[model samples]
Target: MTIESVLSNNRIIAATQLKDIKRADESQCCAMILMNGKLSELMHMPMVHKPLFIHMDLLKGLKNDKEGIAFLKEFINPTGIVTTKGNLIEAAKKEGLLTIQRIFLIDTNSLKTAIQNIKDYRPDAIEVMPGIAPKIVKALKQELDIPIILAGLITTKEDVLHAFEAGAEAVSLSNQLLWNGTTEAITTK
Candidate 1:
């Protein structure tokens, strides 16, 4: 499925360990984001039916550079990549892989820098961390046209609801409990 379809259809994406990949695949989550993995682990990663995205910054033994992205495209071959670097996003775009720019909003300066970088690079999507802030999500939605994926520090069902209410296109979390059955329950509500 296309990235847009994955994001539009699945409100909750499972960000899980490599060992939990199968669980994520079986869960209701429409996509999987592998956060902590080694280059070797990814090289031997089990096949996942859903869209798989690897956090490039978290991968061990892989440089967050164009060469690393090229290697992933040629071998690991995930549906997309999550990274904090704009140059890598450009490189991933060149390799025809979907890109999600992960931005950590620590303060006003950081947020402004993130916004500027996003506008300059223009990845397919943006993932805002410490995603419990509905007000920030609302502001970001007003600032950018790209799809926003809220992640990090999302601990409750209410957090998910608030994120959607703030105009987030999707919410990604590592909670296995939520991954199993949250979409139908919350979306239907």
Candidate 2:
């Protein structure tokens, strides 16, 4: 799990920029959209008005491009999370954007590497995944000062509870047998 485990209190939003904003579940959810996808397409979304997060990959492609920088500055102003490497993170920071790197899955070695990598960048936050147990989260939090947002494979209120219990601050979910609506979050601690 990653920073989503920590950042998402009961009412966290999964920032999205998808052209089709699925019916939003306001109880607790994310407003997410594809960075590469057309933002105008998002207008078709029923919940386009919701706060959304632009992915990092989208920014990476535009890295150091003046036009790309200007576009991001003007068009996507809300908080965005990017899963980029070190150099790209610096470029984004120069552009006044704080991005969180995506750590797809954490094994012992991978988690160790991610922790070190994130520490070097001191990103806005760090995300971890593949059903990371809470014990590991506590360890990571203690080892790294950055907030850890859990992502990947979360599927239930129980998963939310477990993540919180494991010391995660937020959680990201995408079609993992979990409820599809953003409002479907648990009243986590």
Best of the candidates, TM-score: 1
* TM-score attained by model 2: 0.71
Tell me the whole-model lDDT of each prediction, alpha carbons only.
0.87, 0.57
Give the per-residue lDDT digits (tens) of candidate 2, residues 65-161.
4455456656665445466576656655666765677775446788788878888887777667665465678778778877666766666677766
Scanning candidate 1 in windows of ten residues, the lowest lDDT window is 180-189
Task: List ranges where model 2 is wrong by over 4 Å.
Answer: 1-11, 15-17, 25-27, 30-49, 58-70, 175-189
lDDT for position 24 in model 2: 38
Candidate 1 clashing pairs? none
Worst 10 residues of 2 by lDDT: 176-185
